[model samples]
Target: MSPGLQLLLHDASGEWSSAQYTFDQIAGLLMRRTTSKAQDETVAVAGLLGVDVARLLNETGQDARMRAFLLQVETVPAAMVLANAPARLSFPGFRWAPRSFGGIEEEFVRSAGVATCTADGLITRRELTILSFPKVFVSNSETSSPDRIYLHLPESGSLYAMPDLRKLGGEGVHEIDAVIIFPSAPETPLVARQPVVVVSTVNAAPGQDAEEPLECVYRFRAYLGNWSDRFRPSQMYPEMFDRPPGEVFITAQRWSRRVMIT
Candidate 1:
C-alpha cells in the first residue's frame, strides 16, 4: 500500500466498513494487516461479491472517486445499477417493429447535445408528437383522441437485468438504445408532473446498415425522479445518457399538468 492511499472496505449494502490500512500493505489485491483482523469481515463480504470487485479496484488503480463510491455507496447510490431486474427480455427484432415506438428522433436531438424533454417548456400540440396504435379498441369510447396511442414493449421485447445483444436498427427508425414511458397528461401539460420514470439502455451500436445492431445489448438501467416536463436531463438522469447511439425516450401517456418538475 502506498503511503498516500488507504484501502477502503465495505459490504454490498455499503454498511460496516474499515479503513485502517497501513502505508505498507496498500499495494495488494485485498489488503489485510498482520496486526489485526479488522479487514477480514470486509474482505469476506466483498469477496462474496465476486472477483470482479477486486478487478475493478485494481483496474481503477486507486482512483479516489471509484474507491470512495465503493466504500460509501449507501450514501450515494449508484447512478445506475446495470442488472437489477432478472425478467425482462431485450429487443429481438427492434426495427422490424413499429418505427414510431422507437425514439430515434429523440436520440438525434440528444446526440447533438440538445434536450428532448424538460422539467418545463412550451410544447406546441404538434411539437409533442404522438402516433396511433394501428388498432382501435379502448373500452366503449367512440372517439379516440389522436393524442392517444398504445405502446407495448413486451417483456420479450425488453432486455431486463441481463447481458444479451438485441438488434435495434432497422428502416424508418435508425437506432434505439432504450424504450421508456413518460407519465404526462392527456393534453400538452402547461406545467410539470410528478414521479418521472426513465429506462436507459446500452445496446450494440448500429451495424453496416441501420438494420443491424453491431453489438448485443449488454446493459440497461432505470431511474425515478421528481416532477419534470422538459426532456430528460443528462445531468439529472445519467442513466439516460449511459447508452449507445440512440437516446432516452418517453413511450407512455402523460399523467400530470402544471405541477412543477422539481
Candidate 2:
C-alpha cells in the first residue's frame, strides 16, 4: 500500500474530502510501491481502494475502482496481447488487454494501445491500421521458430526479422488468414519499408458490413517491404519461385469498429 493512498483514506472525511489522483500518480505509486510482479501490483491497487482482490481476479467484468484507476489516468492504459502475457482482462472493452503485468515473459511482443473509454467505464472503440493478406500459409514446425515467424515479401522469397515474431500464438503454429493491423505508427520517419506489428487476424473475410466484430489473436513484428525490392524464391523459398512479387502499397483503413482481445 502507498503512503499517499493510506493518508487519503485515513483522512477521507477531512482535508482530503475532495482530493483526486491522476492516472500518472496512481501508476507511479504502483511502480514505486509495489514489487515488479504484475499480480501484486494489481492486488495492491485493489486493496488500496478496498476492492476484493478475489472478486477482481475471479470475475471477468470490470470493477468500478479498478476501471477508474486504469482509464482515468492521464495516458491511455495499454494491454499486451501476445502469447505468454502475464494476465488478461475479461472486461467488455478490455478483452484485448492483459489482465495483469505481474509475470510477463520475454515473448510478449505487441499491445492493443489505441482505444477510448466512455465516462461510464465502457470501452467505446479501438483504432488500428490494418493490412489484409490475399495469400497466407502457416509455417511448419521444422521451419517455424519459438521466437520468430518466417515470412516472405508478397511474391518475394527473402525473409527478414524487422518485426520480431516471438511466442506469437503460444508454442504451436496454426493456419489462418491474416488481417494484420499496426496499433501504432513506427517510431521512425514514414518510408517505403515501414515497420509494422501484427495486432490481430481473422480466418474469413468479414465484409465491411459484417455483423460480427474481429477477434484479436496474436501480434508480431514484420515490415511493409518496398515494391522495388523484388523477392526471389531462389534466395530462400524455392517453392515461391513461380509467384513473382507485386507492388504493395501502404494505406490507412479501419478494420474494427469494435475489437475483441483473445
Candidate 3:
C-alpha cells in the first residue's frame, strides 16, 4: 500500500470504535446513491475519512498521534482542500469602469491632448492619454488592502494591468515598469515574479464613424522578473471604443479615489 494510504488506514484502525458509526453512515449513503458517480463517490469518501480524522485531531490525549496522522494526511487533496480553502482569493471586490474612464479619465483626457473648457480656466493640451481599468480596492481585511491597476491598450486590441503599482508621472516623463507576483498553487505558498512595462500615455478619442478612432499609440515592455519562475501571461481584450455611430460626445470623467499601500 502507498505510505499515505497506509497511514490513513492505520489511523482509522486505531480509532475504529469511535469512528465506526459515522463511517458506516457515509458508506451507506455511497452504496445507495447510483445516480452521481465521480462527485458523489468522492464526497462519500471524504465524509467517511473526515469524521475519523477530525476526532483524532481534536480529541484530548491524542496530540502526538494526531500530529503524525495529520502529517501523513497533508498530501491528500481532501484534507488540503478542507484546511486552506478558506484563505484563498474569492470574489475579489472591485469594479472596472473602462467606458466611463473612471478616476483616471481626466488624466487620460489631459494625456490625450484633449482641451476641456472649464469655468475657472481652460486646461492645456497633452501629448498622450492612457487609462487603466478595474481600479481595485480593499474590500475585506482592514490590515491589508492591495490595489490593482489595469491599463487599456487600444492599438493591440487588448488591456494590460497589474496589482500593487502605478505610473509615477505623465507622458514624456520617466518611464515606469511593474513587477507582479503569481502563485503556482493554492497550497504551495510561493510567489513567482514577472515584469511589465508601462507604455506611453496615449488615449483613444471618439471617432466620426461608428467605431471610436485611435487617438494615439504607446510602447511598453514586459519582462518576467525572476528567470526561474513561471507565470501566466496577462490577458488582452479587443478595442473597447468600438461604438455605433451617432453617439453624443461627452467629456470623460476622472476617478478621484486614492489607494495607499505601505
| Most TM-score-accurate candidate | 2
Per-residue lDDT of candidate 2, residues 1-262 (tens digit): 5323442433744554434554324444433232544445555565444445664455333343344445533134332333233444545554444454434443222344433443322222454434444433333233443233334443423343322233333333543334344343346322455444354354535465455445545443345443334544454443433432321112222344454434
Candidate 3: lDDT over CA atoms? Answer: 0.25
* TM-score of every prediction relative to native: 0.17, 0.48, 0.18
Q: Model 3: what TM-score?
A: 0.18
lDDT per residue (tens digit) for residues 136-219 in model 1: 212212232111121322321211121111221111212223322232444432222111112222331222233321222222
> Is candidate 1 or 2 superior in TM-score?
2
List residue ranges in candidate 3 displaced over 4 A.
1-122, 132-146, 152-262
lDDT tens string, model 3, 1-262? Answer: 1113322233634653323333223333433234332222222243335424443434333223323232323222111111111111111110000111111111111111223222211122321122333322222232333233333433543333344322221122322222111123434322233333232222322222313222211122232222111212232222333323321111111121111000
> Which candidate, 1 or 3, would have the higher TM-score against the true structure?
3
The positional error of residue 27 in candidate 1, measured at the CA in angstroms, is 26
Worst 10 residues of 1 by lDDT: 107-116
lDDT of 1 at 105: 17
